[model samples]
Target: MKQAVVGYKVQNLLNFLVENPQLKDEVIGISEPLAATQTEFVMRRRRSLQDEDAITVYLLGMEGTVAPLPLVSQVLQWQAENIKAFVHSHFPGDADLCGIIGRASQCLPPLRKALNATQVDKDEVLSLFIDHIDALESAKVPYPSYYSELLEMVLEDGFTSEVLHSKLFQDAAISIKEWGSPRQQQTFVAICSICPTATARMLLRYCSYDDLSPYVFDYFDQRSVGSMIEPHTYLTIRRRLEKSLSRISSEINVVFITDSSNGAVAANASGAADATFFSVRPFNKPVTLDTLFVLDAATISSFHQLRGGGVSYPLLCAEARECNSRRAASNEKRKTLPQGAVV
Candidate 1:
């Protein structure tokens, strides 16, 4: 029979994906059915299946590849769960209902609109959902998959897509609080993968640890002496930052002030103003001794200007005044540009 043949082919394909480790890594997408044998495919952990296009192509190559009835049931259950979560998070007070009811309730508004009803009370929908939920739960197959599709949905376009991420996955929110939060570092990188500009410019600026400060000072140090900053502090600051700012364009400027082996110092910027940080990648750009001003007076001046000299997030401010009084002695005129100001 056609049904038997299709079922056999589906089983074979699943076997092929589960058996070949390299193919699983590079091409095969679904591994949820293999969860009993492979812990790596577990939902709460694995991010996604790779090679989306290749998997689609491979599936198309099979002549009349038919998904088994069980697989069809699993897809319906997944859709049911998604609907349940969506309604519970948004509609309020209906969170306790069973999943099948939830899906029917979501469909009510459109159904009513089609039926020419002006206003449809959701309480009736919830009641209908509750009545059918028991039967639905008993009769259907459930998707043994992880939450990868929903997670991926929320992350794309910085979760700002007016149609997709915002409308459907609105209840699922992603937050990376600080550097030390467990899994925050991973979420941070994930955000960068989808929305690098926002991650570098806005998200990092808000974080406890970010590359903004060092990038500013390094850009400034081209005009000053390296001897001003202490060896240990400079290395620590340098270690914390990984020249990733060159990839993002931000108007915000960070002024750093660090304690030195000696007293504070200042930058002696040169005429021509040399360069700006954003707009162009500073690839092969000259490294500056301005790092020497880690805790120097000039950096402090900018911080003070940002927070009105009171304590606040120093690196988060857009603009601050530099104390160039120390540079007053330099007769060699230098045009100091506001970092990212030109771009």
Candidate 2:
């Protein structure tokens, strides 16, 4: 609910880790495979959703499309009707959306590791919703339309608090408003709280959630959330992460965490099988090694160049400058002096 679904904390470490030159390549090595795999996965998914002919047509329409991240980030935010809303706001014709999707197809890999490690409170929250709905039903006096309407709407379309606010609620509200186990708004809020999980389910309904859901069942359900990373890619990614952590001899500490839906990760200043890193397991079990790779990917974040306002260490800069100047002078003198002449 709080974006634990995105592994917000894992992202913080990854952001910092990518900064060091020594570790950057390895970081890419670990993450790139996963990203590449995601790209293929997205492509295959799009093909399934639309068609290859449609995809080709879209590609033909685009001549020069700018980066997709700006557009894709915008796309990712809409709670419902994302593509529909995005097309209206961002594109004039098919070209831009095609281009953006093309770009997104490639780019959504970087942030995925965090998503793979995602843990959500959906089931817990779902249980809470059930309890409230049950309470509301228990206190209600038998009415022909009230329970039928709620149950029909909840089961048919899915649970949403909108039903309580809609015209459908007019009769029910009038009759049930006085019962007050929970006010209509409170009961509705509890129902709507499952929206995030439902949204996640809708997003991942098709693909790899089947194998991975058991690993992180609470965060994932029948609807879908995160899928398992490709096995080879996932294993390679773990190795690369470990490699980067090993090579970078800095004060920075990295804790690799993986979370399953109901899983609990044990960590606390632990190391990489030693005393440097905290091995995180997000599920209740200790199947950190056996479970699917929990590293989720997302749209890639580009490695940034140094910012303009950075202040140099003046003393160190001056010292290095002087040393370089002295070496240059000595080199020039040696060049000027005759070969084998001692002065």
Candidate 3:
């Protein structure tokens, strides 16, 4: 009965090859001797042996052909352990592996477990993971969450792939929550920081001042050589730090500057007093509009000197206007006088 069943299967296979002339030509083109191969098309199984054997035979017959594209999805539908050997053995080329790796989310759970159990196909699978990391980073995969297990595998192997590090940096920049757990975030940071410049710049670009300030300081103190950073990156970080400090200062302290004699209030960017000019006195409480008066010449001159060319004249009262008039007259007289004459 078993011999008749084997003969029947062989006859059906011959009939299939005859019906498909292209597949027949491919089978004839096989250069490698199938008899010398270590793994057989059949394996010992407890049940459904016929079904398993059929899948193996079908996969082997379709080897070295364009049919693996559609065949891969079918093989992926089966148990990973059941079909992984055929996948690694028959579809060992780059194109085939890439196609399978692109659907990593669909097959990674079981196939990853199977691959992790054996050292034989680990390198090939890891290479695919490193090469096509972008595919894993895309929307198809849920990013760090889905790949956390794979990350553990890579970490265990003591291997670093630059692109994987870049992806982790990008994911962390988007949201630290993308790493799922606090432990994962810490782990990712440890790995991602290997590419320090790229990781630091990405965090600087996307993270809030409160979120990234400590990292920047830590990078400078611990990681940066001689505390040196790129000019643009350094300036950007400094500006953010200054702005953050200014916000905190404004919240904690309130100082209103007013002219001692006329009580003219000077408007500054922040409520904190300008310690540079000593003519005005700072009050803790808000000054009423009734106490408002125009700024004097000394105060205007002091404010302009401190603020540079773009000083606003909102507080310029009658006294300031007259001072401007005198300054204009002096400029006109100087233009009319001889080159060496003093105004």
In TM-score terms, which candidate is top? 2
Give the worst 10-residue stretch by lDDT in candidate 2.
55-64
lDDT of 1 by residue, 29-106 (tens): 332322222222111111222322211100000000111122222223333434434443434343432333334545
What clash count goes with each model?
A: 7, 23, 0
- lDDT value for model 3: 0.27
Model 1: CA > 4 A from native:
1-18, 21-74, 90-125, 133-343
lDDT of 3 by residue, 28-140 (tens): 33312221110111111112123322111000001001111112222222212222333343344545444445457355565455445545365566545554454543433
Clashing pairs in 3: none
Off by over 4 Å in 2: 1-80, 93-98, 101-235, 243-247, 250-254, 257-343
**Alpha-carbon deviation at 331 in model 3, angstroms:** 56
Candidate 1 has its poorest 10 consecutive residues by lDDT at: 55-64
Report the lDDT tens digits of candidate 2 across residue range 261-292: 12112211112211011111111112222222
CA error at residue 218 for candidate 1, angstroms: 63
Instruction: Please rank every candidate by lDDT, starting with the best.
Output: 3, 2, 1
